[model samples]
Target: MRARTAAERVACPVCGTASVRVHSRYVRRLADSAFRGCPALIDLRVRRFRCAQQDCAQATFAEQVDGLTFRHGRRGAGMQAVLDRVAVMAAGRAGSHLGQVLAAKVSRSTLLRLIRRLKGPERVTPRVLGVDEFAPRKGHIGAETGFCTGQRNR
Candidate 1:
């Protein structure tokens, strides 16, 4: 499918100044989620707006649609979310197969990259700690004992 952005004015990312000047326009080919068991593609025409601020670091910035597009993204947000879920659940090879079955068509390496990009879950301190010592041999006088520790979250 083909579509174009209709935003009249967009704010500059660096200076926060709204700009209505259009520097150029380009088409971004995005892979969208499956539609009725078929792969979907969106050719979105986005405008590049020139920053109005004189001291802004960014001279031109492309418009991004909320819940649909992101910076340097080739897939739609919905498809990205689906792939993220698959990456978390199945991991590399399995996640790639799952993505193909879902009509997303991603590679195992891509899934692994996605997994690597994800932030790890926050660590929580355990509430209870237990320690125990066990001897290697019951009757041996020179046997060494090993200590083991365990923790409980709640």
Candidate 2:
């Protein structure tokens, strides 16, 4: 386990006060990328502190790295790193299965949710939009496709 935060001082995001004291620390396990067939776990010991500001909006918040967020999840950030790779190199059930094999403990639906989380919201105002769902192969009863018939947005 590595120290999540050192003695380096951090000011409150909402305030400029840098007077804070370390109160305690805890470990958070996150999934990281995989090597071959094995998954990696990142054990981060997060620190807790008390803000000395009398009018601060927030009393405390765990420090976050550039690509990480607190309370976003309990799984390791490494898991999302791996999920990102799988999402890019694979799609649909295959990616889901790969995530499961890596001990993500996620099902196909969960995997899709993870993918959607990574993708975030779509903001494109395209001239045309197409939505469809299809069977993995063919000759399946659940095969479906969707197409937009609306005019192009300006």
How many pairs collide in each candidate, listed in order?
A: 0, 7
Could you give candidate 2's per-residue lDDT for residues 73-130 as a string of tens digits? Answer: 7655566666667776665688878767876655566656666777556797777643
Instruction: Kindly list the per-residue Cα lDDT of model 1 for residues 38-120, writing each as its tens digit.
Output: 99999999999999998899999999999999999999999999999999999888888898899999999998899999999
lDDT score of residue 132 within candidate 1: 25
> What's the lDDT for residue 56 in model 1?
91
TM-score of each: 0.79, 0.58
Candidate 1 has its poorest 10 consecutive residues by lDDT at 145-154
Question: By lDDT, who's the top model here?
Answer: 1
Clashing residue pairs in candidate 2 are 30-75, 30-76, 31-76, 31-78, 31-79, 32-78, 32-79
Question: Positional deviation of 37 in candidate 1, in angstroms?
Answer: 0.7
